[model samples]
Target chain A: MLPTQLSALLADPAPGVPEALDLVSSFDQGLVDGLARVSPSAFGGLVDAFAGSPLRDRVAEAADKIAAGSISDEHLFVLAGARSALFGAVHDALLGQADAALGRTRASWPGGSGDAATAANLLAGSRSWLRELAITGWRGVDHDLVTAAGQTIEAALAEPRLRRLATLLDGLAAELRACSPIATMDRLPVRRWGDLWSRAMLLAQDGGRLTPSEPVTGRLLVLGADVHEHATAVQIQVHGILETPGTAPRLVRTSVAAPKVDTIVGPAVWRLFAAHPVLLGALAERLTLDVTDLPLLDSGDLLWSDARAKAGPPADPFATARVLLAGAAAPAVPPLERHPARISEPVFVEGYTAVDGAFTLGDRTIAVDTTRLPSCGPLTPQLVAASHACIGLLRWDDGGWSLQPIAVLTMVKRQPVGVHTTDWALGPTDPKVVKAAAAAGDAVAVLRERAGRLLRK
Target chain B: MDVERRSVAPIIPPVKPRKLAKVPFVELADGRLQGVVSSGSDVERVYVSSIGAGSHGLSCSTNNNRPCGGLRGSYPCKHLQALLDEAVLQYGADRVARYLRIDVEEGRSLTAGLRAHHEPSPAATVFSSFLRHLAYLELPDTTAPVPELHWFPSVGAAH
Candidate 1:
């Protein structure tokens, strides 16, 4: 049962208000109850701070009796507000003098539990601060409250555990250090499974002029764990290119580019090469082993390469293919095939340490050996791969990181480009001149010149 | 077991091809199999030769702050070494090392397992800074907190 003055103070919501007016409001009932409930009997240690204090008379008077049964919102507000005021002062004390204020906050109270009393006192200032920040957004807020809170902790010596408790609360309240007022939390990234994060940062090296050959210079943000304990996880996302407001760009429809080298090769050929990855590695000139993973950009016809229920690969494509189960290799692939499969030449780029095998194209073994690809700078494996992928991932509609194989039969039928032999295929740019001519939108000249370069190179 | 002798079985310890991804910086430049790992970050750059039957593999730590504890001379410690060991079971030794740049040797070498945690090198600092740049941007560009191993391109240094 709060008296009328406190009740009246709580009822008013607006107009020129005093600093203490915030203490006794509808906003903090717990604060008021906590302050009013403080008792020295509950806490044993320090009996000095309030023994002759001015607050003693007020507590004594409030203890006489409950004049009314129902506790009005206004009454609760006053009690809360008063508690808030005390806590605010205590808060200021702690900020001004940490150790001294700690002692006073622990001093024994005449009422209830010492812990409860401490919590109540702290809650007073805490609630006030919360309201002040909430109501005025901390503008014109008193720094004195924080200082006053520090003064109440005078009894921390023998009751050391109490100090720890007080510190714990304070720490939680302000655990995150503020570098900037705008910065509120320190985020630590956590993932259920270990995986590398991929980020794309676009920076120019030469000039604003996009390379005529490598229009897209995509970089690989490769994050992998050290060992088997760490299965290399990969993620790719687009960065830099932002949509501009107004002036909608004209839409163009085109087929998606198969992953990096989505060359179309027959299934039988693909299997033959898969078994002989070293052979393809040799042909691709990668010189790799089995564990190396490759992305495939497939011809659209083979919508689902792996006939499995799930999108991922099957446990064993070879054995499962004949099992009539999903993800088994299709009948198109066999143990051995007269026709060897083929992948794009870019597979010979740097990090591609493995390939199926070298295929004989005329007197030359058309194995694009990446045996000498550098690993750093502008033309290293990383650099070349980045450049190729960048172009693949960003070139018009047929851009992205993908690796798929299509049947040679399908490629011949579609005739995206000329394929004289089943052994090799060519893109818009193969021989240098053809690539150059193609860039100029002159496909016929480029193709003819590229065919000659192919013979020469 | 290529029972037929053509060797199509993908034998348990398949024949390993040369791992070009193992940046041959120290080995190629100074022609040294031995190198120092100043920061735990450069562990992955190490290339261990003669792993299984003369085939090589690499190992690196994912735990950057933990100091990638059990490395012999290579960057990744024993824990990561074991993880790579199984990679041979999946991707075959040579090809896997090429993609990951980390290898799993068939047989463990007592000498290759030495810890290079203490010794510092300028190349290592450069490698560490490289990693820091990636991390500071909070961009997931490279593998996370690569362990005791450091990667330096063999040719990049030469150039």
Candidate 2:
């Protein structure tokens, strides 16, 4: 049904050479149908031309009709492929502009169910500016397109309930916001990229370094581009040090490209964290929790430590761990261990309070002597609750009875380090305590020394 | 005893003992507990004491963002108070010879049901940056917008 000139243009392998105004100005549904039935190869060029224009709606409409018909799977495949490459971007840019020009619009379209006529008219009317940006990647031409997309996204974000708008816009806003032109990096397995991401993270720190003392298998030394940028975009190199059983630690070199909008690092990273949180888990010492709800990091904020004095302190592992546990159903924990002797006559001591170097329990006011460990002097709420709930090991002397709480036990649910298992266990035991204690001194010194040696070389 | 004197072996200065993977805690003469707490990226020397000899009624050297309430003549602040509580748990009631009576009596009720507050360690800092970057570079095909709860807020003065 398309005219001969339009049909000829659709079949051209290397496109964009058509008499631009004549071909686009007279676009119609028959032309799209002809292209779908005949020259599917030219689909990509079609998208590039009309992506942010009024013709996008018509393309969507035609594609929908074709999809509903007895169209061959091959034609359908070509159409599907071109939607992402062309229609999706143009649709986003157009809607972005429309929403901004109209101001605080309602979530009416709901993705596949927009008022076709209105959307078509709005987009068609905006063609003057879109036509210029259609073919060229020049900066200023697409300003309204990009800005509108950004603004709509920001508005939707301001009120979380507006996510219904996401489905309405055919998810164009999101696509536009997170859109990147790089080749897919996710095609690579997590294990490969995980090492690169971890190493780059460590390297980003001031003297950032990690060498798990335990000899890990598949000790990979990766040299890749920065995780945030595409391999082809920029050329910042990073190295990964893999410790093999017999071989010297291998140094793998890597590089990373910068993001399109440097400001996008936070949202992009946050989304990634949401999708594959195990990536973060791989780096935790004792546990790793979901950190997607954390605030966005500023440009270069991720490089700073949680203990930074001025601003943008690092994310609190303990708080993150606690919040993660609180969000889910509390896992079944090991039953509280009870003293064998006191099981039958478990003393329900009431109104216990801290006294001078001792504790007074029950109406009798019996003083439980305190410990010699200076670290053990202060009484905490958990210690109090445990004392009330469970009968502890007690020693009776000339002064009276004394109880020493065995341990500060709380059931902590988290994914264990290295094993990738999520389970709940009574924590602050010897292992966690030891890990925390060692982190401040021995672990720091060891890593620092190793780094110093590496620097010396 | 002059049996062909076994050649006195030369003493190689004991291989500078490979720095222990675990830092050793030193006990001061006054019964304070000093040790390096290492949880991966965080490494620092922490000192714990039972008696508050300083003007503040506490002798801990750990850094805290909030002022010590115990220093203000109120109940021991969460920082010093946590130290005392940890000391009791670290060393059983038998060995610790001294403790503040006010905390034993009043501190229990005041801090009851509250989770013990811990100072952020250097290791925690390392993990934050590591995890952040790891998530940034590698998650594939993120064109779809994530739910709002998953997005983290930028750090502001709220903390």
Candidate 3:
């Protein structure tokens, strides 16, 4: 109901133009509050609809302009609609009770508040509610109060602002109508989007953690280590057979879908299996680096040496400064104690692991989860073979580290340009880390070679 | 969407030290360096390029002291817009938009997207000395003037 109407109901009612406006405002506020209160179910649609809305700034500006006379009040209805939405949201979130006055018998009680903070629980509850409610679309929020408030604004059919607000709200409501009511309630008693994330279950391909790092030759630097591929594997967990306890568990695997290229350009995806609303909104801010910058601060030609792969491996990481100082006289130092580092060929296909900080292949650093590690000392036979396709190898030189990129077989370039040299561990998954770095390095070598040949000719 | 990816044709005429009078060094967007000098008799122009993509633009008074924090020079930056607006006021918006459409929302700026790209100005010199080094390329369009700048984005756009 409009504020004036609310005021009237609270005391002696008045009938006038100002009163009518006040009544509209009061109703608008209540509706917005109600919408907010019943979010996830009744109000979430409005919030989602507003999140990255292209017309958001425009709508807001139009409203402000009309209110301030900077522009015509043609936008008054739009403003009123938005205002009412806000008020409805708050009401649905805090005050709206889910008690059905009429006698009823149902067992959909997944009650309480504190548990809202646990996303797993929230997600489970949401899923259950959807299944039980058979919710094919956004569910209706049965807030008598909000319904009444909406009516008050609707009653003022002549008010253009109020009418506009109703039109937009209708659209928002349509989207909201698809969710389950109880599941809609985020952390609030009814529903409030601010607490929405605590109860949502994110999806994979939506994101990933920092994958391990790999060394790459300068030749592999052509594509830079920013390249990556996202995939999902179905995990099967089968236990007792439905027919008998003796039956072996048949593997039941679940496969998630893949994301698109736009989704590929985010660190959030690099850190988690899924993306959140806020993070998705921030996607536009993320940067997709081109492999071109690796050449700066480089220490020189190990990457472009034509005979690298065919030639012997780099000087052993264990080689002492005294030995390195000896130069060529010292036959290629044998892979030494601590293996000082692990290395990768520019076009190597296998993922690799490093011991103690001796990251080889073109990488100086690699982020790995100790738990996900294949084994302790050096690299396990499995890891070595798996990580054999190195982007580059790390060769010890005067106690300093340098990378050589393995040419990516994909690119026809003879030599790669550079290597990624960052120290941040984006995450700790195997494919996430090693494979990601490998893919990036793979592309790098291809590009670097192309650029090198381009410059050469 | 039709970002002209034409190869850098090796058509530049060699400059003779005897005839090539160098320009005085001056500050540029990137602190590294740049300078401008007149070369050809008729036009006084310069090819503003940078080593890092992030620093490729003329150093306007405002950004002179600021390092351009861009992947390859902040495209559609205020400095670029200012320059374009000035150009629009001088040369006319229609012409500027016609020859080099500046698409702001799509991340295109006249200076960054339209101006010629070259290596970082390691040292400042009269930009006019290498005027021919620059080439104008088209950029995508901004949000507001979508349809006006040739609709059909779906026809092609890498993004």
Candidate 4:
């Protein structure tokens, strides 16, 4: 229902200047509040209705002065209606500019045919659309849309015909600011942004060991591995994830360097993997070699050649050398006992019994000669298995007495587990040594190819 | 809205090298020779041209180092000469020559849009050179002023 004074004015349709100003004065908050609700066509009609009216011109002038801070303590009720009417003028000017440019180009120019419709239609949307976009920004940032609109308007401003669009955009920016309590239209609360990553969990460490929890899922995007190094260790800090799309993406990490993994995989290898995670992932997918055999440094010449053929040049030549040297077979040399030195004094050496021999000590059955003294008895396979130790005179050492311990020498016996490269048993389980080297080689090859492509272009 | 694409045509002629001083000359990628030469006013005119797509205008103004048409060649136009020298060195003589040929073949347009920016100075020269380089990079700007200058793999070395 219209106000009684406004209904009276509408019935007459063409009020005198004094009467028109009095009728507009009746609306204070209502005029400013309803500005966003008016339809573009209806706003256009109002602009046309007040065309060349001195009262309308005075109102627009007074609004401008208020904005410029030249007028203060003025009657805002009249000014608010003027501001609402001012939006109508802005709408008309923008439409005219777009129409003029479209007519000139016939909808084809720098961006070509399809873009003509997009550019014009975006500007032609209702004034309410801009307000709606501002409101959206208030709740949560739609940065891509905001940036596109801003850029489109900026580009339009360069064209002489579309110059007025800038003024309209400035006004819309103000309206958007008004829609929000926050001073900046783009600033938004964290929880308001839907689909943006808002939660994080870190791996915990206990007793010098890294304890891993389950990886976070759902709305997952990218996981960035940041590699940093100290003197003795290299750390791989995973830098969370990017959860939302924007012109300028903002990555939110709730924790700083959390759930870190430390490895002595060498700086070169870590650097290679960390520098180009995407390239490494791509290469890993394409690789036909066993992941267990990765970082193929310890492999012989045959494996090296095969890796080079598959992955291109090694990324870090030094790391490759270290792997190769560490993996090479031992040099061919006889034991020290076989060497011709003077008949040495009695030497004591520790060893496991290999075969049946005389002289059983404890539960050990040592295989060595003890027939020279009565302390030993004849050795048999059963007795030797039962015996734990024995003494013998070694012929290999010029009759020096030797003692052998039959400590459990079974192949099934357990050995200490460690990350040490020299630990033979580790070869089957831990794969860091191999993966690091292979990744380094692949990274070098990929980076070189990328650089080459860019240079040629 | 009634607008049409501006038509473009070549308006300026090749530079007159003789009007220039007997200074050392460096030939640019676009078939134009840049050198310090004396004009009829006895001032040394820095002879620079936007040669490819034809000459954008070849009247030698004094280089940035000196007042316009000053007498001394001692203050050579470093901006024009240095940038050209660097370009020639970085992108070999053959590549630059190839670029020149491409520009020459693509005759200049006379359209208002094709008209060189009003501030026709060393700054403009650098900007035009940059645009040509972007074309070399295969940037997708069909509306770029000098599309003919765009690099093509088959177009000699610069391509």
Q: Report the CAPRI category for model 4.
A: incorrect
| Every model: iRMSD | 25.9, 25.7, 26.3, 36.0
**The TM-score obtained by chain A of candidate 3 when compared with the true chain A:** 0.16
Q: Write the per-residue lDDT of candidate 3 for residues A86-177, one digit (tens) a residue.
A: 43333222111111111111122122211112233322333333222112212234322122323322332122212222222222222232
Report the C-alpha lDDT of model 2 over A1-457, residue by residue, as the tens digit.
Answer: 0122112322322222123312222222222123224333333344555568665665554455453443433333333333322323322333333223222122222122111122322222223222222222221222244344333333332332332222222122222212221122122111111111112111112111111111123222211111212210111222223333564433222122221211122112222223333322222232322222222111101111112112222333233322221121111101111111111110112234545534443333333322311121122333444342222223321112334332222323532211101111111224653454444343223434432322232
- Candidate 4's displacement at residue A429, Å, is 34
Q: What tens-digit string does per-residue lDDT give for candidate 3 at B1-159?
A: 111111010111111111112221122212222323222332332222222223333332111122333224334334334344443433344334433333434544445445434233322232332221110001111111000000000100011
Worst 10 residues of 2 chain A by lDDT: A337-346
lDDT for each residue of candidate 1 in A252-319, tens digit (9 for 90 to 100): 11011111000111111122113222222222221111211122111101111111111112122112
Best-matching candidate per DockQ: 1
Q: Give the clash count for model 3.
A: 116
Worst 10 residues of 1 chain A by lDDT: A192-201
Using Cα atoms, each model's DockQ against the true complex is: 0.03, 0.01, 0.01, 0.01
DockQ of 3: 0.01
- Choose the strongest candidate by TM-score: 2
User: What TM-score do all the candidates reach, one by one?
Assistant: 0.16, 0.17, 0.16, 0.16
What 10-residue stretch in candidate 4 chain A is worst by lDDT? A198-207
Weakest ten-residue segment in model 3 chain B by summed lDDT:
B147-156
